[model samples]
Target: MDLDLKCKTPILSYSDDEFKQILEIRGKTLEQLPEDVNIIKEWLKMQPHLPMHPTDRQIVCFLIMNKFSIERTKEKIDANYTIKGLMPELFSKSPLHPDVQKTISLVSCGFMPKLNKKLNRVYVCRLESTDVVLLDGYNYFCSFLEMKTICDFSDSDEYIFDFSYFPMKMVTKFNPMDFKRVLTLVEKVYSNRIAGLHYVNIPSYAEAMINLIISFLKPKIRERVRIHKSLETLGEFFEKDQIPKEFGGTGISLSEICDNMNVLSKEYDEYIKESNNARVDESLRPTKLINDDFLGYHGNFKKLQVD
Candidate 1:
């Protein structure tokens, strides 16, 4: 089997028919939720129907976009780049379900809460560490054997319960591995939302995408090529013996590794260049220090001081 990069292009090309299918599946799940369920009933009564709400579709598409070809996504981002930098402000507090309001308050003052074009309510949060965006249209109201339970703002058991009633067709095409990843992402997002952090910065989105591709291409390769590719990077943490001064790995240094893996490194570089429509050069690679400003620190929260 040709282990090709799955991200040759962004998967933002879903057809209108496919979008309709997505909505139908989403709406089906939304409607099947118990009518007596506090927030569910309220949400359903207020919103129009599936496919009508673009935010939900955008969330789903964003996840799908993560799986798209890096080159393709880069082209799209470059063409309409400004929009990408400004993280979509979907996570808001005011119009939220009381339960959601309380949950998010546990972590943050919350940002950007907008109405879906169809005017449905959905909460969006970005995880800076992971470059992951989370969407929550279903508010957090739980039911026990006999009673209903509203999640407290401080409760941190953030998780994405299976919307089991959703039509199976909606997920039949998704890989099992992807399903697990999506679920984990959703739960993490919920946790962050409640905690009020924008996101957790692991590898930046670019590095993560590159690393994901490397992992996809060579499932067994363990090296972190997803990071900078050079001697300078490796030397910072390692010593002449090629052992990490801090740890024990030989500080042989990344400069040495660059020599050893020049070809593979070039491949990664070329891929990035092609994505951004830039000439293939070391300068174009995404090896700069991670920018902290966009890492989701909403800055100091000081209400105006009235003299």
Candidate 2:
């Protein structure tokens, strides 16, 4: 029987009263129809193998009325039910095709159809060794996947403390006042350390708070502010990511340090208004003003000469 397994077998034609109603209704042995599937592995192949093609039986009966088990395919044939009977009203109205929402997030555990943005709904659940069920009840995707798996095991040492000194350790951990308050304290320290500060001794406390805010802004810009050659050229360009956040630029030349701190705060407010007008013209001098009769002329006008 080896003419390549008799030309890869699949040739049944039967019709003698449909093989006598399949040998009087019960006993069956026809087989060979399974192989079709390919509309990109029946919608993106992440563990597909179900009964599949008969034009994907209304998407495998809307993934078995959204329960998602799959692996039958013997050929029962007969259940169009228009889009599997409007899949509970098409997932309760709208947004499916991201390959039928990742085949309803790979049949339920490795779930991904999110869109919850405050209950807008596509129902979120299933990703923890997945079993494929989330049609609307995995309690907000297993409490946001166990809060992102305990925030990825508490930031497994903060992305190895290297986001090019994440905007200079978030503008020296909020020592903000300008440079647009250090870019709003680097967007609230990278959105609260990528949402819930896990850990890795926070990049040596973000490299000693960005080396104390770039050595306190190079000694307030050089009045003998010897910042050891601008903190060793911004600590070797913040350890080689090339600086710019306004001279400390990681997000590069951060608006030239807010235009050099608004042109050095308008030249330190015109040098404190010309040093308070030269200390009021060297402590200004003034003479006394005479009053009344001038004390009847000093010693009676040198003894009675009526001047």
Q: Model 1 over residues 1-307: C-alpha lDDT tens digits?
A: 1211111211111233443443354352333322213322233244332112222222223222322223332322221212112212222211233533334333211111121222221222222121111222211111110000011111111111111122333233224343333222233222111211111122332433334433432232333122333333433422334222222234333233223222222333333222223212223323331222222222221221111
Give stretches of model 2 more than 4 Å off: 1-26, 31-78, 82-133, 136-307
Evaluate model 2: give its lDDT.
0.24
Q: What's the true lDDT of residue 137 in model 1?
A: 20
Please provide, for model 2 over 48-87, each residue's C-alpha lDDT reduced to its tens digit, 9 standing for 90 to 100: 2222233343332222222222322211111111112212
Residue 48, candidate 2: Cα error in Å is 32
TM-score computed on alpha carbons, candidate 2: 0.14
The stretch of ten residues in a row with the least summed lDDT in candidate 1 is 142-151
RMSD of 2: 36.8
